[model samples]
Target: MTIKAVRGKRDGPTLFVSAAIHGDEINGVEIVRRLLQHRALRSLRGTLVAIPIVNVHGFLNNSRYLPDGRDLNRSFPGSPKSSLAGRVAHSFFNNVVAQCEYGIDLHTGARHRGNLPQIRADLQDERTREMAEAFGAPVLLHAKTRDGSLREVASDQNIPILLYEAGEALRFDEVAIRVGVSGIINVMRQIGMLPPSRVKKPRRQPMVTDQSYWVRARVSGVLRALVPLGAFVKKGAILAVVSDPIGDTSGDTEICAQDEGIVIGRTYLPLVYEGDALFHIAKYKADIDEVLRHYHEFREEFEPDAYDPANHDPSEYDEDPPIAS
Candidate 1:
């Protein structure tokens, strides 16, 4: 529960950027680290509150849920007089999120899953849509507000926010971190909290989709993916095949895409049970060619080795207090 506030000399909108609410999602934590190092923050016009680790208990335990086995995210806008998770959420809302005019909640795929870099926002709001487009991810999902989630509460308070999802939990992906850092900076600039970047906007808009679904494993076995993440697939295209490790094709089951879409997420671990989520596809109802063009440009921009964090030091994070026995 560490919050670092970088306040600008001039008065402007306060923007809060939070990460690691699920604890195991370390990519967001790293993104905040790199974001703090940017020279742009020195000239920032507004406040940037960085909360790299929110779930201290779950983070220390390498788990997504709290010690009480409650999902911290599901206990949002919580109570000061309730469970530990609820109290923590309540404290966070009051102390950190209360003052912010805007926010960006960073995240990654759950354990054993990897996600393509994307922005999930309520596009119905013009302000939110502007921020999402400014962030410049290849995919922009018009996600609905889930009950008890931070996004829901923030929207309720009329504070527009974006959820940047990428990479996988418990690991650092350089590309995801780069995209996250740059995207946050972009949003700041878009809202006049910071100076506009010299970088140009994408030639094409992000693949905006209100529809996405998980392609589940059809059988219990070792899953082998025939396609890579970010690959576009047509309806009924084979995405993966689940087969026994002992060369038993007799029980093989091929998982096919249910719609023409892009692979937004996939399972990293080969072992899976029947009905386990294997692929998450985002359908492009229109502008498929333009979307593909943007995808290639995004890859070229944030390709591996384009940015290296090894030279930068981000060790300012504090250790959580030890629990009493």
Candidate 2:
């Protein structure tokens, strides 16, 4: 693990930003790189703790689990006398996470999947909601922190953390990376780490959802997605079609939405078996038109004409360079 601290001359929140906790999720690594390149941090009032790659063992192997076949994320607040993953998690919690006042964990979808830019936070926390809104992602999920997860561990210590999910694992999506970098900077501004922007805030507020579910394939076949990610669909809407690749509709199955929700995640690979999750939807209580309007506005903000830093490759810092005393 590598750590970078950009401390301000004045005292402020120590925000810990971590990425690549799942190893294959490389978009967060790029997000951290781009975040370090921003000039706004020069005027920062707080400390920014950046750890671009937390699971070095998994990252080097391009695998999501550690050598011991354990997910590093599930081993939070681990013990020194336990497994390898446990030891790693224990060291991280003691030496790094223990020192921070706030945190932002970046992540992407698993293999063969893509997620729309969204913030998964505990809405029960008012400060967390404010930070999530400030991040300005199109979708906000009232996600409950899983047991033994980083968010839960942080919450125990009274540190509010936000998790940003976007793109796909093992690949960098330009749109995902751009939105992530901007979102992190926005949160920094909102929390007083950096000066506020003179430009007005985002025109459309992020759509919040408390209920989400995965629409699974009913039969084994080649899958065809009818709607893309971020699409607003009503209950019973057809989200995808599964058909036999050899031009047979006898085995076809239409995966329909079970609730009026937005498509927050979907399988990118067309081939799928029965019970495979195809479209992940999030239900909202407000008018569907409002969600549609917000989605459209978010897309327009990232039009081709707009500047995107992900279009260029930024140099990554060498991990743990020797510091001159």
Candidate 3:
């Protein structure tokens, strides 16, 4: 594989965990690295293929798409001779990924954005949904699978892949890292690839959303956000407003809400052009209030400050004399 991969021992199943398919989405990259160094893997039952980075070119450039202006994640099952990104994707699919029975592709929002560590997958696929639940990120999105994605290609091969979205590109958020790491470990346990789950679960299952849309800026200016990730809002509530940097233009135009939902994701950068996506609101059926409550409680419970692997000396995990390829 063009990308670097680390494999573990055991005979149960092969599970693939990949990150940085979108170069700027570094949260997953770190998650995969930390996962590999996790002490729990000492007792892992199946082979765990951890690819900390899938799109090296874009990762180096700190951009989301490939150098050829293609999104690597969308160029899956790619041709070996297509392009730099394509070759990388092709090699990964034919090698590391093809060996897996279950997979979790981690990701984060692009520049200036943040997501609440949610699992977006095809709920109609029973196995896919089960893995999502096993992943155990606070919110689960029952999204329709998109085209040209690793998720799509893996599904074709009968491998269940759950896409975990969190944090932001280029910048790592502590909360995002903790949730993602715990979630992936949870998935491994659920698939019989790992012995047991260390992640604590809620009394009820996750809230799944069928569709989600972005709330954009109403005017070009600086933004003062009133609602953060996982906050609940009613129809017509003032989520945020576009204010002129010069404090002009009707004293800041308010961006009124168009629907009642929870903020699954939001942009971190305050400055915006008039139509830039500022908030991602996913609609749900029942338990609207319950969703928000669960999100915050879970987030607090997994405070990123307490789990710094660096301080904990993660390298202690690389002890097997570096297994051969």
Counted clashes in each candidate structure: 0, 0, 0
User: In candidate 3, what are the lDDT values of residues 1-325, reduced to their tens digit?
Assistant: 2344444576778888888888889988778767877887877886777788788888888888888899887788889888876787788888877888888888998888888889998888998888888777878888766777898888899988899998878887777887888788777777786676556555445778787788888677888898988777788889987887886767778986788877888887778887898889887658766766777678677663334434555565443221111
* Segments of candidate 2 deviating more than 4 angstroms: 303-325
Query: How does each model score on TM-score?
Result: 0.92, 0.92, 0.88
What overall lDDT, based on C-alpha atoms, would model 2 receive against the true structure? 0.87
lDDT of 3: 0.79
Per-residue lDDT over 52-104 for candidate 1, one digit per residue giving the tens place of the 0 to 100 score: 99998888999998998988889989999999989998999888887899999
Tell me the alpha-carbon RMSD of every candidate: 5.4, 5.5, 4.9
Lowest summed-lDDT stretch of 10 residues in model 1? 316-325
Clashes of 3: 0
lDDT of each: 0.88, 0.87, 0.79
